[model samples]
Target: MEFANEPIFQWMSQFAYQPGMVYAGLIAMMALSAVGFPLPEEVTLISVGILAFMGAHPAHFPPPYEGAPVVNVHTAAIIAFTAVVASDTLIYVIGRVFGRKLLYHPRVHKFFPEHMMKRVEEWTHKYGAYACGIFRFTPGLRFPGHLACGMLRYPVWKFLVIDGIAALISVPTQIYLLAHYGEPILKYLRQFKLVLFGIIGLLVIYFVAKKIHQRWAARAASR
Candidate 1:
């Protein structure tokens, strides 16, 4: 609903106004988003849903032109799902082929860092194949977790199965929900965004406090 006034609304509306540009753009952006680019995949899907609600096809695109392709809920979901899986698989392969050596590279470490990689390494060892599914739900953890899974030599078939299952649960849900309930869902998402950020901030504070306490305790014990 807010897209009516926003710049992105104007930008995406151009694509939405066209009969087929929505699908092409969504597939491309979704692929980029899955690979950890800053592109907002979920927001784009929701916009596609709204476009579906408004009938993305031109007003003249009814009747005899019904056979012609246009952006719709089903097509959007399928394309998004496939794009997500493909991009994620590509990242997994990059990690597998390059292994720990890539993860340790200074340029890569600037994004993935040694600490995050170590945490992901522990998680992979603890959870084995299931960690792939776990990482699918975790945004910041995905790059490192998937990479760690490969560096740790997790089975490729198992990685695909787990990641695919997680994608099934996450991908279609966003597109269909927005398509069916655009305004209310966006409102809820806006509110949920604040709450989610607050929660993450509190978790960060708690962990830092806990680490400081542990360090102090260790010093006292040494004395």
Candidate 2:
């Protein structure tokens, strides 16, 4: 697979004008992603970041009408963090609830890709499912990472910590970039062919590691 293209960004950009749209959208996006439905967050994040830069909302400062100082970067970051945490928390609940039977059942297999399922199996074995943190930003496996965590029987606290750490690393940078450069970064993205390919390459590495780990684990079990 490949990193997402302009169309995804374009679609998300359409929602930029709606009031409080990104607040809702950000929550939904993270929630859905946590549940194993993958959407490229770059567009959603950039849109939110840029909109904050524009008048749709302010990134660092609260609106003038609040009769108080506008929300600052620190506050904005906290709010953004809350949205992601809420979404990931829901997915963690799904994992805790349905993990044991997810892959063994026939219906789920139909909905999920077999190869990726096998890969997740391997990755969970190696990293103990909390590795969802590691796979959180991987191109194709970000959502699957959550499902894999459940399948591996990862503890909730460990899963949360790992996922939280990963989010802190990824979310802030996207927000910072958008807050500063706004939509222009999106334009720059269109021209960066190499970056798109690099993303695909990283995803390739992620799956490749999964395959290797699975093989190694099977060998160890047999021994």
Candidate 3:
């Protein structure tokens, strides 16, 4: 609760204090995140966990209200999982309705891009339907990957089963962990933001460098 003094915590707590607002916010944010909004879903779920742990419910709000409702961690987790599945399903439906045409559209192309789309397509092809499960764990690939699955005519049941399993593993775990062990984990996250970013940057650089080297080696091999 003392962590409410932090700006990020305070911001989330504001919404959390309002009855039903936090669930609505989480649904919107998680849906957008699954569809490729820049904000990561994990962070959002973790924030919700921290807020729930801190008891940032209507009952905790300061004012004339003497008895307010408590925040429901289970409800929050369920909402998050549903939001993720819903968003991913929306994209998959778009791909199914439009088929290959969706991939060719200029605006959609921007999200997939040519090279990145190719990589995702390759993985999906190599792994078949299971790619849905794999892509669930790979952030940059999720949008294009799921879209490709539908465009490629993957079965609906398969997509749902694979994706749901992956989401079950990821979405609920973060919420449960933070809801229970939130204080220390949140403190660690706040303290290590810079470190986390630095590691992500380094990984990006390494992958780019490795790709460049591979291309160079291929060209030299023909000579």
- Return the TM-score for candidate 1, rounded to 2 decimals: 0.70
Worst 10 residues of 1 by lDDT: 56-65
| TM of each candidate vs. truth | 0.70, 0.63, 0.77
Q: Tens digit of lDDT per residue, candidate 2, span 1-223?
A: 0212356544543444444555666667766655544346665665567655544343322244543232233444555677776676665566667874764455444334557767766877887755777777774565556765765567778877888898888876777767666555655666784797698688668756765675566556547
lDDT of 1 at 12: 42
lDDT digits (tens) for residues 1-223 of candidate 3: 4544667655655554453888888899887777766556776887778767766433333423555554568988898898898888888888777887777665566445457788887897799999988988987778778888888878999899999999999998898888788767766767886897688688668756654664565456546
Best by lDDT: 3
Q: Please list the residue runs of candidate 2 whose C-alpha ends up more than 4 Å from where it truly belongs after superposition.
A: 1-19, 56-76, 183-223
Poorest 10 consecutive residues by lDDT, candidate 2: 66-75
Collision count for each candidate, in order:
0, 6, 0
For candidate 2, the clash count comes to 6
lDDT for residue 210 in candidate 1, whole number 0-100: 54
Using TM-score as the yardstick, the better of models 1 and 2 is 1
